[model samples]
Target chain A: MQDFLTIDALSKYYANGFEALKSINLRVKESEILALLGPNGAGKTTLISTICGISKFTSGKITLAGHDIIKNYRAARKMIGMVPQELSLESFETVMNTLRFSRGLFGKAPNDSYLEELLEQLSLLDKRNSQILELSGGMKRRLSIAKALSHEPQLLFLDEPTAGVDVELRKDMWLLVRHLRNEGVTVILTTHYIEEAEEIADRVGIIDKGQLLLVEEKESLMQRLGQKQLTIELQNRLEELPTKLSDYDIVLAADRQSLNYTYNMRSGRTGINQILSSLTQSGIIIKDLQTKQSSLEDIFMSLVNETAK
Target chain B: MNYYGIKAIYKFEIARFFRTLFQSFVSPVIATSLYFVVFGAAIGSRIQEVDGVSYGSFIVPGLIMLTVITQSISNGSFGIFFPKFIGTIYELLSAPVNFFEIVLGYVGAAATKSLFIGLVILGTSTLFVEFNVIYPGLMILFLILTCVSFALLGFILGIWAKNFEQLQLVPLLIVTPMVFLGGSFYSISMLSPFWQTVSLFNPVVYLISGFRWCFFGISDVSITTSLLAVFSFMTLCLAIIAWIFKSGWQLRT
Candidate 1:
């Protein structure tokens, strides 16, 4: 399928030979939310910066809405809006002027009605005339989004949009992002919040150490790589796993009250039955059992660690 | 450059400058007035005339040009510096505006500000000492040249500046000293012949001499020399700024 935004073989190397991004390729479909998950210095911001033409890429090609990022930067940039992490707004300008100016920056015709709607949507209507420095942190964050949306861009990039905001404001931002996607605006969000990706992303891409590790639909990624852990309460505190149970790959708890086994969901054999039979053969009885499905956070951690290796 | 995009950024910067109109418009006047009082009046009372004009009246053109040079640099540099430091430059770089539009918008607004401030100081100096602009056309020409020259200089300073301390380095250490030693308060003729020869090395001297020539109809340096220096300096600065914008020197890296 054709993508609304396509990044091919993107790479960046600073003057001092620091490689920021390495051969990252991504395709974002129209009107979908793609959560880019990564640890610090994982090249998330660098990718966004390159795509927006703010930072020069060492080598790569990016196309936005069918326009080349370098050859047709103006048209490509006109279709995309970005909200940076920092709330670096003009301290003295009114909120309305900020949005109006941002819209004009895109060469868009003045549409006070649209500006008004954006202000209202961001809950900034009452503060439209207020100075940016006077607004609260959350208000400033909202204003950044309002400014980005003011241009009526088809593609929106949020670089850690809710990194340090309060929980309530984060929820508001999430709903607002969802609303934007519903309106047919594709959102490419970079975030450290794994749960936020789980809650809102239609697709997730894990990037680590300047390389893209994986990109897949959220549910499909979970189903393909998710693991289930089985914990069995033991009848006795065994000093070690019995020889018969050793082949089951079961781990004994420190207090000897539990045995743990982990298996991939996609694998046909869960190993729970085999482990139970091995335990029975070793004359062990389980008193209680519980299971835990691998969470998005767990998958993210393991993926990042594996990539590091 | 997109015309509308340049207009928008220009308006945004102008609005920001005027948001505290009392501070932006009034502070320069007050500072200039203090200089006029202390240096133009008190100091001029002791020193004799330079050429045929009173020492106080002699410095008016230089002082006015001084204000234009310093303020244009500060306004242009800080207007962009703070944004870059606080990370809002990312927002601008990501916008649809091209680099030319960005430079034009910023440098244009900064020039406008210096022009406004120059006129204000010119009007204020009238109350202290009476002096006629011998060549109004030339005076306006020099005013714009000085503004654009310093504005481009400031544009370079803005990109080169990395922090608040770096922002203050040029205006305070380099520019202010140049304005002082460039003969803002005294004529280079007052110095020894060798010193007079050395004063010709200071770029600000030509800026001041050219501006003062427009008012008093005479200059310490030849009018042709001053005009040539101003034009050459402006051209050099413009070339450097255009290169910086083209290469995305400090802005992109």
Candidate 2:
């Protein structure tokens, strides 16, 4: 089965001898939102640039809809669009002219109606005649997305599309990404915010230190990595763990008021029964019990720490 | 082919040039006319004629060369350099168009802008002196070739420039001195024999002589050598540009 976008062992080594991207392999299914989560200098932008053929890769292959990004670049590029990490725009051009010009660069016929529709969709209708420099940071970013989508590309790369915007604009971008995905526009977005992936990505790929650490479905990755904590409210403040409860991974709360047992939910038999029975056998009275599943942020931090080692 | 891509980039650059009309077009014309007034009044009386042409008319061809060369180079460099500086080049590189088309769009627009300036300076010069073009066709030919070749050189300089100061380096340091020393203000024959030989080695001499020949039917070197020299230099600049794009030098990082 041919993926919509396939990166096979794509590697890029800068002339300064800094390896920006290690041997990376990734396959993005058609119409899926694949959130690329990584920390800074994690080769996320490098991978996107190399795939777009802006930065030449030292080795490996990138194919967009069955065409090589290098050899069949024109055909391959026509199927892709990129919203760069930087807010790079032709500052003097009006939103309309820039969109028309960008679409024309892909050899696409001039379609003012389509551009007008795009403007309306992006809420840029009022700013169509405005020069890019006059637009605010949020508007400029929307124009970047509009320009990237002007050619009606099949695959889109949004490199930190919502990196620095306010919460409102970030929500707007997430909605926009969801809209694109609904229209079957395959999206690959890189972000450091784990909650972003949690909100919209169908799948998530974690990358760090120039290498891809893992790629898994959003639901599965959550279930596989998420930890469940069982908090037992003590009838009385406890000083330490008893010998009977020593076998479990448990910690006393800061107030010395409760026992917090941390265990991976993926591993069956969360040791709830064992801890509960041991507590009863030890003659400790429990006021109440509560369970909490860790969020994606904690999982991401642990994953990054795991790879750093 | 990417004609649309070429046209888009060309329009983008041409629009940029027009936005700064005073700086891009008018300043050079005003400066060139002042040269005619000062040099024609101050130096004209001292030396009556250069090769039977009035001293005022004598420098017209060289003046055009100097202004056109510098205008094209600076415009070409700045047009591309600003995009790179502001990070718009990535948008260009990521587009579907090839490098050659990108270069053609930029170099073509730069050449066109400089050609218009060259003709404007020519029209302005006619206001000051009465001169006839010996071969109007060849005159336009040399003017256009000079604009294009210098524009190409500017493209190379733009990519190689790390900063704005470096962007002006070639036009100010190298091209200006070469044009001045290449018989712009005086005839090479007025020099001592040794200096005359040294002037013969300056590449701008061939360009000026060929251009001047189109005006007065007088030249310092045979017309063929002049043509060969300009074309060869243009070809060399083209080769360097091709190499730069192929290696992704300064463009890809």
Candidate 3:
């Protein structure tokens, strides 16, 4: 896949000398879903704003479809669409008119059929004639998506697209994002929801304090950092871990009825067989056993914590 | 040139104006009619003529100028200000449209709106007083220039203003007073020499003077000077707007 968007050494600074975005570099491939995960004030919105040309960058270069964002902004901007974090919409305008206005703003000819199809996909077809103020919060979020996609932009930026919504709507938004990617619209979304990134993102970029910590394939990221835990339930309660199990990374449960062993899946030897033999020699009778894999949330927390230190 | 982008913004703004028909259109017309009742009937009864024209008829040009100038500013300022206030301006800023297209859309719509209101007030004034436009073409030219120039100023105000209070401050405190004391009601000639000389500095004076010349062929200042003043004001406004877009001062920041 070709890089549809390339950002090199981009930095943004306020007049008061606050660094909103540090020297950042990234490339987004066509038809790929890239999720940017960050905490509050992590410069997620600022990055998206700069790419969409809403905020001016102090230095560095960004190009969309091989056009420099600043020098060739018209061509670059025409190919890009952004759904802002805030539900900013014309309250008095009807849903359909809002979409039409957005499409026209991007210099596209009128295509009501395309717009109607978008509305239908977002379940907003019934509310096309309804004014924005009349819609519910979820409906407004959906309308923002429809507006962004109205121009058929090759690149779409969804900034916290499901920030405040119900579980059902969040799922719907995820589905829509996946559907957009399938339609060959490269999607870059900023979110703090680990589940959202884990569920839909093909690649995940972790950012902290205006710096991108890492960007890698989601599965690779999980596999490289992920840890697995094995639980051994004992029939007889133990006051502490036996000296025989000290060689392994194992801990006795606080309740004294079970033992937990942590190991890396990527390692050639997990030592499960040796640990079981050792436990048997120590006269520990295992009544039940279970294992659990570390979730992406755990990996994310550890990475952020490492950076915080 | 992004003509479609300009048309989109222009149409959106015009639609908003039509949506609030009473506030945008009817209210100004009603206010102008009341001015005729109060100033024309009440004041005109005492002063029968001023500069060889009926007191009722002489104020016609000034009345239209007042509405056109203020309405242009209000319409222009609010058109951009409301979007900023609601944060919807992000769409405008992020769109493929350039600053020129954006300004044309907003300022053009504002001018068109003020022009409509000015023409309506002119028509409504006829019910109370009779007036003839000696140079109908020049009258419209002045009207349009005022609308466009003042609308450009309003666009600047919209971008510069931080809040609603700030948005209304200039129009209320500065512009409205300028129009009133700018000889909108009485000729500057009525003032003593000292005050009359001071009134020459008021830009609105030139606008009213030039517009009045279109109607009765009488003006407080020469037609050439009036035209020069209008052009200079417009040039200054365009320069400021250009700077705003170039620096990304308020809108982009």
Candidate 4:
């Protein structure tokens, strides 16, 4: 896929000399879902703002669909849509009017059918005529999505789209994001919810303290950094871990009923069979065994922790 | 040119104005009627004439100018300020439209609104005073120039203001007083020489003088000077707006 959006060595420094964004480089491929995962004040919003032309970057270049964001901003901005984190809306305006206003502001011809379809997809058709103030928090979030997509932008930036949303709505939002991706709309979403990125992101970018720590394929990152744990449930209670298991990264459960063995996924030999054989030889009767793969959240925490050091 | 973008913003602002019809349109008309009652009927009964025009009629142009100037600033400032206050300005900043289109939309809507109110006030004033517009074309020209220029100033104020108090500060403290003391109810000639010279320093004087000339062919300053003042004020506003857009001052961080 072609690189639809590129950020080359972008840096932003405030007048007071606080660096909001480091010299960052990133390229978003067309029709891909890129999730930016970061903690509070991690420059996720700053990066998105700079890319969307809301903030003036101190240095470097950004281009959208081959147009320089600074020099040809109109052309670049025309192809992009952003749903901000705050649910800021014209409280008196109806949902339909909001969509119409956004579409028109993006220089797109009014297309009622397209907007209606968007509302329907987001389950907001029933509330089209309802004023924004009358809508619930979840409904407002949906409206924000509808508004952002009203112009049919080739690239969409969802800045914490599911923040404060209920679990059901968050799931629906994930589904909508996937649907948008299937329609060939590239998506860049910043999220504190690791599960959101784990569920829908094609690629994940972890940023901390105004610096991007890494950007890699989600699956590859999981494979490279993910750890697997094997649990040996013992039928008989063990008072202590036999010295034989100490070398294998195994720990005895506090209740003395199970043994846990940790192993790196990338290693060729997990030593699972050896550990099981050792357990059997040590007269620890195994009732059953189970394994668990570390979730993206675990990987994310470790990565952020590494940077904090 | 992004005509659609400008139109969208303009229509959005106009719709908001209509939504608050009583506050935006009717309130000013009511206020103008009260002004006519106090200044035109009560006060005019004592001072029968000023500069050969009936006292009631003479204050007509100044009244319209006052409403137009203040309304233009209020509407223009609130139009942009509300969006910023509510955090919806992100859409405007991120939209494909440029600064020119933005000004055209916001300032255009604000001017149109003040123009409507100004014209309505003119009609309402006629109920209280006998009036005639000698140069109807020039009257409209001055009306529009005032609306556009002041609306532009309001846009600057809206961007520069950090809070609601700051937003209302200039229009309330500076603009309203300037309009009242700019010879809105009386000609500068009514004042002594020292005060007359002081009134000349007020920029609103040129606007009122120009607009009054449109009604009765009488003005404290030459028509050319008034026009020059209007243009200069407008140019200054446009220059500030241009700088705001260029430097991303207040509007962008």
Give each model's clash number: 0, 0, 0, 0
* DockQ scores for all predicted structures: 0.68, 0.71, 0.85, 0.88
lDDT of 3 at B105: 96
Comparison by lDDT, 2 against 3, better one = 3
Model 1 stretches astray by more than 4 angstroms = A231-260, A263-283, A287-309, B38-46
Tell me, what's the RMSD of every candidate?
4.0, 3.9, 3.8, 4.0
Could you give the CAPRI-style class of model 2? medium
Tens digits of lDDT, candidate 3, A1-309: 778899999988999999988899999999999999887888999999999989999999999989999899899999999999999999999999999899999999999999999999999999999999999999999999998999999999999988888999999999998999998999999998777888899999988778887899998875655579999999999998878778898998999999999998877799999999988998889999999986655666777777679
**Local accuracy of candidate 2 as per-residue lDDT tens digits, A193-303:** 877888899999988778888898998876755678889999988888888777889998999889999888767678888888888888889999999876655666677
In terms of lDDT, the poorest run of 10 residues in model 2 chain A is A293-302
In terms of DockQ, the best-performing candidate is 4
lDDT of 1 by residue, B1-253 (tens): 5776888888988877786678767988999898889877888788888888998898899889888988899888877887787777887787777666887888899899889989999999998887888999999998998898888888888889888888889799989999999999888888999988888889999888888889988788887888898889888887887687678888886
Instruction: State the lDDT at A156 in candidate 4.
Output: 96
In the order shown, the chain A TM-scores of the predictions are 0.82, 0.81, 0.81, 0.81
Would candidate 1 be rated incorrect, acceptable, medium or high by CAPRI criteria? medium
In candidate 3, the residue pairs with backbone N, CA or C atoms under 3 Å apart (3 or more residues apart, or in different chains) clash, namely: none
Model 4: per-residue Cα lDDT over A74-192, one tens digit each: 89999999999998999999999989999999999999999999999988899999999999999998898888899999999999988888899988989999999999999999998
Model 2 per-residue lDDT tens digits across residues B96-214: 88878988899999999999999999999999888999899999999999999999999999999999999977788998999999988777788899999999989999999999999
Q: What tens digits encode model 3's per-residue C-alpha lDDT throughout B31-51?
A: 999989988998787886889
Q: Per-candidate interface C-alpha RMSD? A: 1.3, 1.1, 0.7, 0.6
